[model samples]
Target: MDQKMFCYQCEQTAGCAGCTGNAGVCGKKADTAHLQDELTGALIGLARAADGNHPTGTTHRAMIEGLFTTVTNVSFDNEALQRQIRIVHQEKEALIPRCGSCESRCGRNEDYDMRMLWTDQEDVRSLKSLILFGLRGMAAYAYHALVLGYMDEEVNQFFYQGLFAVGEDWSMEELLPVVLKTGEINLKCMALLDEANTKTYGVPKPTVVPLTVEKGPFIVISGHDLKDLKLLLEQTKDKGINIYTHGEMLPAHAYPELKAYPHLKGNFGTAWQNQQKEFADLPAPVLFTTNCLMPPKESYADRVFTTEVVAYPGILHIGEDKDFTPVIKKALALGGFREDTVFRGINGGTQVTTGFGHGTILSVADQVVEAVKSGAIRHFFLVAGCDGARPGRNYYTEFVKQAPPDTVILTLACGKYRFHDLDLGCIKGLPRLMDMGQCNDAYSAIRVAAALSEAFGCEVNDLPLSMVLSWYEQKAVCILLTLLHLGIKNIRLGPTLPAFISENVLNYLVENYGIAPITTPEADLKQLLGEA
Candidate 1:
């Protein structure tokens, strides 16, 4: 059996290229990587079976969950991955039970070996990589929405089309449209998720959260699943356990339903990449509800709990029942900090603010337009995305810090942690820096930009808005695709582009969309603000 693995579906791949060694950079073992490949292949087979047949809700969910399972840092447990693979197979068999017993065999319903895609021509491989990775990211959003009892049929069907396309032998011309279409569909997916969240939790509003941890038992909830966090909040209510948001969950502070809980405390840590160090000897048990789960350290591994498709082999996983009893017990045993401890963000500020969803921002659309029209606000910069261990990520912090007083910075996702604590002051009554929910809240940013464009009678690009984005994983890939799909050009993406994008495809994007890698903060800021 081959013991090596090949994967480059993320920003931290080896040598800025594919990971083709015994283990992936994310600490996925060779065996686990192989299982993920098998799971992906099985998903392709399920998608192939649904190509002609009308897929049911069960089939759509299986496809979404399967694709999301293979995302970087999502699933490392071989057993759990195998279970998902079996579920895919069962769905395929239910779709076409007679395929295996036919007198004459046709390979149309066979499972795809992912190695075929991995070893294809460079350009085709790059295009398919974009589609597949973008689909994976979109699936995460779809899963979040599904759990909230909201699912878009178009978004669900595209999962099958995307998976089947991954297995097809197609030209760059044929595949490029699918690549962009992944983004197009993901835009709808984000919209669906936005609707699911707003309808379920009420529109988010501007809310300020402190960084202090009161002396009591607390559970730190990470990842991007609001439903899971809500369930935990309900269960831990009046049980003497405080809930603190971490990573992408920091945006929970903005939602009215989530923030109403008095015990739902402030954020605890910075970005996902800092978990290993941040969780070291912590007093509370951290529950991960979605992606960005780094392999836990031995010191705090016992206190880390995972749920909702996030699984690490040795970590305690809270199953579908969403029972957080184990986590509560662990937190109570630890008893939190003996004294009130104030935890500042990376910027040394003791508190940060969030909420500024599309509803909140658009409610003040007239004010924003008046400010921009009067030249009181020169530019609007959407500096957002995930945060990683790369030292270059500090660019976001500096970029926001150096923005002119007349400019407004709209940020989302964990990347906001870089400067969310800094008091950037306000323009009129609005803060110079506004926190716009989580990574998925890129939809909010889009809505706000579209409203601004409509008010000014210009395209989104023509508005005084520049998108300087920093991506660290697959979610960023899909959001980037969504931006390109909307025909919003001149996007500046960095801490280096994805290693999976081949030279030709990179050139194509550069020629058509004017997407460029970010340079120094000073030069980029000057260029963005038109001062260079």
Candidate 2:
């Protein structure tokens, strides 16, 4: 049989060889995936062209848009993908004009083949994969920040450097450091976003968000953005429509300004992967503010809405006005589930607790320090990342399940969905699973780590914290890079390392940082706890 279009970039890709055949597990057709790859290749070429020159605002925006478009489940239309490819080409051609129209053509102006990077030595490939995936995830964050009038110069420049390196010939010794550099730079990028978000929407505080949906009209907001959710909350305020957050949006409850909106109700569903079924025939319209949007099912497609970096054909898109009138109208039309709808999480808990952001964690810094000093808290596990459908991923579930009662699990991103519903009770009133918000809220994890280190007068790694991460996409990649950038050690990553990382690159990560693929929850737990 002819080889299918291989794209195992996501955890749920078909047969672990990518979604070859006709359509992706995400319902993306093969052609759309191919076009996305083309867009990526063109982005590499654009970066190569700008390697020696200044990348203009237009080029930067195009680069961010191109990468954001390729994020899993973000786009499914081939036409949209082609338009993005054209935009990448236009940005590149605009940056570097063919001087004198000479017959001496420069290969530098041509699209950089992704295969060239993919087929290289394992180390080089792995390092490049880190840069590519890291930048892709960073672009998503950057795009969100940019929309909110926040942009960082260093972050934009690294986008070029990271992409340019992907097409370069380099060894493990040469490329390994860039892998970590990607992380280092992403820290700055994420910090910029943190400043942007908190500055734009007040620092998040502890707030009780109910998961129960009140009877009457309501809208479900998902993805990782507070500003968009806030704007939606503002527009819909007093419209008689209640707003429930879903996925990363759950953390919005912690923000003072957002939580103040009485209409902003509790959380709705779990992570993005479960959206199709979760939203099926839902009475209320769902608005996507960012990534992790799976392809729409016919069941509730009409009620789906997109805004800012999120787009779906025929779905009502609330534009810059953030008016949200259309979404509000849709919710009233659907009328939500009959009577009052009470939804429980995957772990069978009717209510899940969040809002334990950096602010809340640091406010009780003295107590946490006391707890640690007294041996009440043995270790801290940052068990977070994008949740997916892999079997072994149950490792995160079991890992959190098996965490010693005294240990604290600081989780962010959708991976928490695996166990967010589980009420592991609390350690001194702090819920066992403290959600620090979306993946971008990894900033909160870093903040808690840094604060704990300060309290102990030691480096972050010296604290009893192990990053047991589950990555399914580029955002996770960038966050992992950020962790490594901080010189964090002994991270346990699963369900499997990215296929893009070559053996050499894996070895470099293992040798330098002691990062390892996850084993059984029992085995990994023992090793993490130092009992193995």
Candidate 3:
């Protein structure tokens, strides 16, 4: 009720219920949080205005950008958020000019107050949260696809539909199916992004990248934008500087088009959660192309630069020019490591491999099938999601370590940083541990699972696979909904269930989908292996 604010969208919220005070657990100031809420409300108004009217490309783009900007750790700059809110408002006015004098104009000032959903009945709030958060996550994927000049009308239209439902007074029964549809639509969105990425960048192949930053002037590119990376690689091509991928950008080394750049060197650090310490006293500028950007620490604050949707106050941001002049100059001025510096993953391994996308994996479908039939591989554990700084996240590391030698571990997103470096070795010819690229690359995992299911003549859930995922934010929300929509059962989620989910909704998932919070690694592995 106070102006302080309330948010519980991420896994590590205050008290695991909500963050209600001066700031959120992600270091979002109260003012910034309010601005995000305002932006969301404005988006809802824009969705309402466009529901029955013709909307332009600009309308759709604003909706996508507005939703993505609200993602946790994506944008912490109130000024940027205000600018987006104004854009949404303008789009709404364009859709229905002089709607202010219309008889059906929205109350509660103008836009739908987000507080209504936050304070609604627990069941309604839970269902709406599922839809809203899932929309936010799906928007990230849609935005990526749009960046590559790829657009799906079905995907874009769903944004308007979902946002409209959020503002409506729909019942639990009415909202339940929409929640699942969010997953269904996100599948299409992810696929659109997959096509865009592969067609534009070429299919990814297995490439082992060192955890070493090469000597000389270099730049650290973080977040999940391949287009930005390609541009940086092109601009810095003949320059004396080197570029290293960090966080989710680590997968860029696997794309054929991106890998062709000689200066697009190795990955620099581990997950986003450790960026503060990993980048402390760094010698080069770090360009953030998307989310998982924490409030920069003053120690390395000067080196932090933002582009696209990721922004923080006092951070120098690269604008629409898509120019890397500032980033390049900073990298040159800083003069990277005087000598080659090798950094090890959390497990102390010096190298990691990625780019095992659907195309690459399915290319060896026969090999994978033969390996499975020959009893060389047992259960597959998909330990993937966003990496966070919360305690108990070590569960992923232990789960991978405790997985039997006969089993295979399929990892993606920044969460793979936990155990990716561990030498799980190979079962047959396939590596026991395979990095499936970034979060949206979950599409690759889905593709591989569907193919394996087809080969085995059974449903995906009936295969020798178990998804033990670690979630931190909204992207995880949409992916979970997608799995649920696929009717995949027995998903193990952790380190903590989403705070936005009420007890009733949690029970519904547990009853219908066999969803459960993850326990100890040994116990979970035993149960998943049918040996409990």
lDDT string for model 2 (1-532, tens) is 2234546567666765456686778777766766777898999888877766667888889988888888887876666678889989888777777753222123465677666764566566667777887888889888878877888898888887777667777666776677778888888878888888888778877666666888999999888877788778888888788999998788788878787888887898888778888888688898888777887888889888887657776677676677888888888888876677788888888877777878788888888888889888899899999888777878898999999999999998889989987877777666677888878889889988888888899988777888999988888888888888888889998888787766766777799899998999899888888899
lDDT of each: 0.90, 0.81, 0.91
For model 1, residues 169-280, the per-residue Cα lDDT tens digits are 9899999999999999999999999999999998999998888988989999999999998999999999999999998998888888988999998989888998999999
Give per-residue lDDT, candidate 1, residue 103. Answer: 23
In candidate 1, which residue ranges exceed 4 Å CA deviation? 100-107
Would you estimate the TM-scores of all the predictions? 0.98, 0.93, 0.98
Q: How much is the lDDT of residue 376 in candidate 3? A: 85
Judged by lDDT relative to the true structure, which candidate is superior, 1 or 3?
3
TM-score of 2: 0.93
Sorted on lDDT, highest at the top, how do the candidates line up?
3, 1, 2
Q: Which candidate should be chosen as best, given lDDT against the real structure? A: 3
Full-model lDDT, candidate 3: 0.91
Q: What is the Å distance of residue 444 in model 1 from its true position?
A: 0.5
Candidate 1 collision pairs: none
Candidate 3 lDDT tens digits, 1-532: 3669899999999999999999999999888999999999999888777766777999999999999999988999989999999999888888877645333334322588998988999999999999999999999999999999999998898998898889989899999999999999999999999999999999999999988888899999999989999989889988899999999999989999999988888998899989889889899999999999988999999999999999999999999999889999999899998999988999999999998899988999998898889888878888899888889989999999989988889899999999898888887778999999999999899999999999999999999999999898889999999999999999999999999899999999999999999999999999999998
